[model samples]
Target chain A: MKAFYRWTRDLHLWLGLFLSPFLVVYAVSTILINHNATPGRDAPEETSGPVLVVVPDEEDRIRLGRDIIAQLGITGELGGVRRMPAQQKIVIPVNVPGKRQVVTVDTTTSLATVATKSPGFLSGLVYLHFAPGQHLVGISGNWFWMRLWHWMADATVYVVLFLTASGVYLWTVLKAERKVGLICLGAGAVSFVVLVCGLLF
Target chain B: MARRGLTYWNRKLHIYLGLYFLLFLWLFAVSGLILNNTHWTFVKSKPVDVRSEEPVTTPAATDDFGMAQDVMRQLDISGEIHAVNRPRPKPPHDLFFSVVRAQYFTFVQVNFDEGVANVRVRKWGFWSGFARLHTVASMSTRGQNMFRDWWMTKVWSVCVDALAIGVLAMLCGGIYMWWQIKPKRRVGIVCLSLGCVSCALFVIGLRALFT
Candidate 1:
């Protein structure tokens, strides 16, 4: 019994020491998130940019589309390209969106122009979810790390559960147990059961 | 009189807040369980499809930037724009535009000439709640961050620190209770050790993975 108690004491102390920083972060973050309620409400707005086109001639838009298809390394199927000379526009179809880039080249001059979207917070969040690469800003949506934190938090929960269970165990079968201790055990058990059911179901 | 009164009030406030803190312990327990067995519980996710159309415009600072704006206008979506990178080694960088218009965020990539566009949206929910608690991102709020110059964020940080202390205290209390009533039987020790070992193994195994 004493050995078990010592083990619990050691386990509790060391784990607490190791997880202190995490606990503080978790607790405070919880309260903050709870109060704030909405992440997107405070999140920044989306940004936009212009489109530049480079082409040898207006008819060369198809060849330009093929070049882009090859350069972007489209693994998926490629669709045909259409040129709207009246609008000075070129549209290409592909399995994936934005797999094609239009380089509008001046027919008379060698001037060329390109255009793309402005990276925004929302986009960063998506990248973090799907393909988290070199982008540093997407850390917020990276659940792999967050999942690890939850794992620690889960361990702490088990410790608490053990404490509750042991408390009940010591109360019931152990000698010199008082009626008040038994009552506390019953109450704790009922309370814990209710909480578990409330949350799980 | 005022000094004594203030001290008394402080003690009372501590006791009151301590009780409130107990509520979090239960929350930690219940939420932790749900999070761990996410597979068993059904957490539904919905898909959002956005469509829009906008007239083509003139060239801007960079080819990527010009295309990105046109696409967002076409989709009838708005977001905050981040960096515009055109790496030499990689394909001509499309303008990467990010927008945090709601509880979620969207990323849009546009090629030059408004010819190609890729837009993705990310929404936050069940998992994010657990994550928000983990990072202490909001701990930097005004009052909380004060523990460190950034008081708001520090509020949760301080609470986490306190939880560690509380766990230590609870361990001591558990030990005191056990010592007061020693269990002689092997069964008791076995039961107790089983739970403790599982938890210990969980923590150690996790730490090992990261290290």
Candidate 2:
């Protein structure tokens, strides 16, 4: 039992150390999101640049938007596309590092207007919080660095789960702070249950 | 006074950082579960009652933003006006504005060409309101509103950055402490290797299967 306690303690400590950075991102991002305290709410800077080549007979606005983006020399994953039929324009939102740029293309003239915004620091952090992972098979096309980040995020999840379990064990075994630890653990467990139940039922 | 050994300090750091992280841990765990299972009807939303007035004169064709401002002024819906949507320049293009408060949200849609304004209020239930916080990131007021924007956006962002670094330190210290326990070296390696292998396999398998 003594050896078991010692092993558990070591396990908990190492796992916590390795996984804490990712956990912090999760915790902070969750809080900021919950409070609506995310940054980057300001209007983007708009600039009318060179006209983009009009895709002949391309009715798909997303494709046209992508084409326009390529022409404008913007590099990043396509985040979203908003089509405004009334204005005969397609707005494509591109997610670049620490910034979001919008490309507006006029269907009639095939001219493009680009608007860029440096999403506030919090907003950028939030974006990092939910960045998507690249696929392992079937045309794995995301950037190499982004794929690495996605892999890290995936590994972080399992590591965190392991750490959470080990943390509970550590709390139980450490007699010196068992009472206080139990209280904190109970608070977390009860809050989780109550909140979830309140929402579900 | 006796000097403390490295292990003692390491354990102390671990304990304190763990304790400090408790509240945030709980918040994320619960909110994360909620976010993951959004398909569940855990949060219910309803349209709020809105009072409509006579339609005002249509604003100029090029000034959709100005028209939206006029609509807000007429309806007396005050808060940070967030442009929700600006449709194309065709006739009857509706301009959408959103005002988010602590408890509820006010959405105003105006058809500038038709000179019509429709206001809708969305009252969020407790769970829904709580869940909505996960999606809230706005800087409607930057420098002008220091008290609100500065504290909420800028200050909170700094906290997140610091917490990130602190977490990394905690992780590193934990591994070092574990390494010092030579007797358990074999067991530690086995367990860590198992974890890493399983994680790698799961990630690879998932990507192969899904994507």
Candidate 3:
């Protein structure tokens, strides 16, 4: 019995350490994702400028795009350019609404017209919470590492659930405080069920 | 005379609640794993295909906007028109139309003038649905069954606040308990101090990041 208790304690503590960071991230992301409930007013910084961009031949649009993004100091990855025989579309992250801004450069005239993006505080936060890109290290998606962190977070929830349950059992073992413990447990159990059922139906 | 206060009750509840919920801990863990690894699980699994065909007639005069709306109405059958996709006077007519049918939503994209169309459906998965409830959304399955939100979320939030208070009580009580037991066991004091330091660091870190 003593050995079993010791094992459970060890499992709880070590598993918790592995899972804590994930839980924190998950919890924080959950809180931040619901933007309307928590209100904050911070104006977005905007800057727009025209730089000399090279117009590539019909065949080498890809190489030309890489060159332009590199020279223009644009952040994030450059997705493939859409090139029609007559017109070529350059897609980049412009400070704007809509996910990516498509720049249509006439095959005949190289003149580029810029459209502005609608700015908001929550949208940026939502982007960060969902895509955690634009960290200090430039534009990189969280990728496999981010998924691993999320997996750990998932694991941690189970540990917490276990900890909650075991703690309740321990409370039952404490005969003197059985009445109070049972009341709290009953309340918690009822609340958990109510919430689950309420949402499910 | 010293009277034990509400802090004591809080400590009692936290420990008890934490333990009682442990049985469901595995369920949470498993569900979370399934939720996160949706790429590999049934969470994202496509339902078995069931095909039922319905015949519908197209409108006589085909303006792009009218044709697109006609297609959407036919597809939705019962949904309300939420928004219309209007293209600027351009060659490729804008391809997107939005509609809501009950809890479900669909975005229809049509070829500007060609009328070639594609549709996307949006529906939340089970675990993702639950997570939405856990965070903050007025709509949830639980509400359907119990007609009440997770009273536990409100309860647990209060309980956690109380638990935080109870932790302080436990620190004090543990010290007293240690002092009483010190004659028999000498190392408890050192262990307690280390535990206290670790907890302090956790609080400081949480405050720095969250606040």
Candidate 4:
């Protein structure tokens, strides 16, 4: 029993140390998102010279955009792809954590103009907060880094679940702290119940 | 003596806050996992649909949301008023809006001319209900970034903020306690530095590495 408790403590300490940065990202990003304030929200845009890339016949926008970006060699996740028939162009948005660059291709001339905007550091945190999100339904990430981020984010949460249980165990063993800890736990439970019921019922 | 007292209080606060936020953090973590891997067989949400029509009198309110509230009251539907739209379709329909709770989404489309509101309620099981809790603040659509009108939204948002801040506090306290263990300081520094560098590289270095 003593050995088991020691192992749990070590697991909590080491995992908590190694994953603290990722944990802080989730915490800070949630607060920033709640306030509707992320840094680099108003970063300026820069447009680059047109690069030639053929827009081939394809029904799916993401597939077509992927083909186009594959030719350009710039890496980022693709947002919704739409074509402006009047302008004879297809516009695609490519997004990384800190930057969003729009690729507009002239179906006629085959010239692609890239408009890039950097949303800065905190926006990067916010972007990482919801990368490879639940939306885009059947579509998977085309960018390597975005896909990697999905795993890292999920792994961090898994460790977090483990940490929560271990934390409770560690608290329970500290007899001097038990009274204060239970008080805090009970208060949180009641508040959580009220908030959830208020939202649902 | 003062420093000793400060250290003692810090430890107490850390333990207390950790216990307070134990279940609070657990909900977000579990729901977050469900959302992150939404394609999982058991957690994938398939909302059950029920469609009906409710008779509603034209209320005196002129604004779109006020009229939505009036219609909601008439029909006994409750949840956040996600959106309200009147495209003024040919021959005029009364109002179109959706009310969404954690477990169900009720879409209401009213026809003032006919004195009937066509209602569709799509409900989901707990797996999806918990998933819905993860995104209560993010109903913002393109061209519709209205402030959340529901009090529940405000409370939920504030709680999330508080929980996040508390976690950060506990993080600092945890590190302080580890530092007090003289033998673990070297290893702790290494682990802490690795985390900081890895996150920095992922957040800022990825674009440079890939592009």
Candidate 5:
């Protein structure tokens, strides 16, 4: 029993120490999301002056959109392309963490305009929470960090689960703490059930 | 005496809150993983039970949310209302709102011309439902009047706030507890530093280059 307790304790501590920073990122993002912290005051910088790109002859909207951004000398995850066949124009959305660019292209004249918005670093961290999430699932994140951030996010969650389980075991080993811990555990269980059942039924 | 007592309670709260929040932490955390790993083939299951029901009687409510609820109650359906498509000016134009849940999702499209509500339900898998829990009251979900239309959404929102705050509190308590262990302090410092530096590099480093 002693050996097991010590092992669990060490596992919780060492893993918690490493995982806590990533957990902080999740926590901050959660707070930002729950509070609706997407402040609209900060305007986008459209000053990527005289954007010139070679309009490729590709017929596919996604490929054409990709080719335009490649020639324009900017990078991020490309979003859905809005095509205006009559006007021969396609609007593309590209995003990284701190910045999002809306690249509008004119196929006929090969003219392009880029409007870049820095949603702030805090916002960048918050954006990581829902990157190629459910909306655009089953696809790779278009940018490097967006893809890497999801990997980190996945690790944090798995650790949190392990830490929670180990925490309960460690608490159980302490006879004095058991009573209060049970009360807390019971209270949490009730809250979770009531809240979920309330939503579902 | 009070200061000392407060410190003691803080430790107790940390343990207890961590305990109380254990299941919630697990729920959100696991749900988070499900949502984050949508690239997995098994997780990419499509919505099942796709069928439209016969037209039902419509209701009269002034507000968008209230009207949605009236439509839901009349149809014997219940869930948070989302993806509201209000009376578009085009052919087959009608007011529509989705009744969203973990397993069952129903769409209510009110056709005033025929004076009926078209109910389309697409039952999703458990994975999709679980993932929906994490995003229940998130900014992604649409609401008006602070989710006043859905009592459950309001309740869920409060829980989300409490859980986030509780986690932060537990982290502080854990750090405090770590500080008291003289022997483990050095290694803990190294562990924490590596974690913090790595986090800063990804979050702050990427932004620095773009700026």
Candidate 6:
């Protein structure tokens, strides 16, 4: 029994050390999300840009989008395209590493306006929490280095599961404080079950 | 003095829990900030290149899925098809297919009338990559062969479910420990109350202003 306790204690310590950085990031990010505390630039940058010169003969929206992106010297991947026939406009949204730009073209006049927003340091940190990983068959467009980060995040979920299990074991070993520990455990279990039920139903 | 043993065990458990989950707590707090303020420019994209080829005859297949495969083969794009959208609003019905790879996303639009497919590839940077990690969840069977796909998804999804419960346990353990530690009970109670009250007030204030 003593040896078992020793093993659990040592495993818990080592795992905690290994997961310290990830835990800190998750904790801070969660609180920020809860409070809606996000810091960023004061205002988005807005500029008027030239329109596409070579509009496709077939009026292909995608082709027209590419032409506008080229004419305006927009840098980044095309995030999305929105067409408003009533307004006679087509909006192409572009995303960069830490910024976003939207180029709106007046379909009738063929004029374009571009607006860009750069993220702040806090915003960047917040985004780290949202990194996507390769799961099942859907591979993200992130490179190996970025994919490594996602893998770490995925690994953290499993680590947390182990920690919780180890925690329960530790509580069992500490038989003297069983009452308080059991109460806390019960409360947590009830909260989890209730919340999960709420989510499902 | 009679409760010394209980106090000792409480402190031990509390310390261990703190040590174990400290970083996790911090991560959630910080990432939460980014999610709340999406307007911030944390991710930036730079237009790379546009490649095209001679227009080819429309694929014999009429369905979007089959056509998407044909487009993928023609473009030499490698990845599983994430989504295919066919908005049947008006003429010139553009067929959109989102192809995802490990390092980039290829957005393909097939214009049947024009006999052309426009391909746009987007690469995510470090911050954007990090943001993606925060939102990672269970993979749906939509684009996956459930039986043959990677087992990581099944394992990770179960872990995530346990994580929710673990977090609750951690919070409960923390509060109980705080209550049991007589030496620090007063300060702990004050801090805990302040945290709870402030959180409630802030949430209430936000709802009042936004909702």
Q: Assess each model's interface with DockQ, reporting 2 decimals per model.
A: 0.05, 0.08, 0.13, 0.66, 0.62, 0.03
Per-residue CA lDDT of model 2 for B1-211, tens digit only, reads 1234777777766665655555544444444445444445654456456555346556554565566666667776554454446334334646766665434567776675677777777666666556544333333432232223212333333444444455665666666666777986776666656555543332232333322
lDDT of 6 by residue, B1-211 (tens): 7578766665666645433443433333344343333445654445354545436457777877778777777777755466767333144546777764323567777777888777777766544434443433322232333121223333433434445444555555555654554765565555555544433322232223221
| Model 5, docking class | medium
On residues A121-152, what C-alpha lDDT tens digit does candidate 1 reach at each position? 22222222212111222221123443343355
RMSD of 4: 2.3
Which rank order by lDDT, best down to worst? 4, 5, 2, 6, 3, 1
Q: Rank by DockQ, descending?
A: 4, 5, 3, 2, 1, 6
Model 2 C-alpha lDDT per residue in residues A67-182, reported as the tens digit of each score:
77777777555655667889997787776435667787787787887777766445655655665521122212243444455566656655665666667677666788776666
Residues A51-140, candidate 5: write the lDDT tens digits.
668877777766777788888777767777778889888888887776788888876876898888887778777767776566755334
Model 4 regions lying over 4 Å from their true place: A56-63, A82-87, B86-92, B140-145, B208-211
Error of 5 at A109 (Å): 2.4
Q: How is the predicted docking of candidate 6 categorized under the CAPRI scheme?
A: incorrect
Q: Write the per-residue lDDT of candidate 4 for residues A1-201, one digit (tens) a residue.
A: 999998898889888999999989888988877777757867998999699997888998888999998888777888878889998999999988888889999988999999989887788888888776677755547677777888888898889999988989998899988887888999999998888776665
Candidate number of the best DockQ: 4
Which CAPRI level is candidate 3? incorrect
Rank by TM-score, descending? 4, 5, 2, 3, 6, 1
The digit string of per-residue lDDT tens for model 6 on A10-111 reads: 555445444544554555544444334555646567566665444444365555666777777664435446788899888887644345578987878877
Question: What are the lDDT scores of the predictions, listed in order?
Answer: 0.41, 0.56, 0.43, 0.83, 0.75, 0.53
- Candidate 3, TM-score vs. the true structure? 0.46
Predicted structure 4, TM vs. truth: 0.92
What lDDT is obtained when candidate 6 is compared to the true structure? 0.53
The residue pairs in collision within model 5 are none
**CA lDDT for candidate 1:** 0.41
Instruction: Name the weakest run of 10 consecutive residues (lDDT summed) in model 3 chain A.
Output: A133-142
**Candidate 6: which stretches are off by over 4 Å?**
A1-7, A36-38, A41-43, A46-116, A133-139, A143-145, B1-211
Candidate 1 — which residues are off by over 4 angstroms? Answer: A1-201, B1-18, B47-122, B126-131, B135-152, B183-188, B196-211
User: Across residues B6-122, which tens digit of lDDT does each residue of candidate 3 receive?
Assistant: 445544544654544432344344554553454554545332322333333444536654665577566653333444553332335344555433234456665534544556666
lDDT of 1 by residue, B1-211 (tens): 9866755454333233333344446555654555345444343345355543234343454465555555566767653333333222134434565544213456655554555556566655654344334333222232321112222333444555555455445444433333334453344455456545543433333233322
In model 3, the Cα lDDT at residue B98 comes to: 50
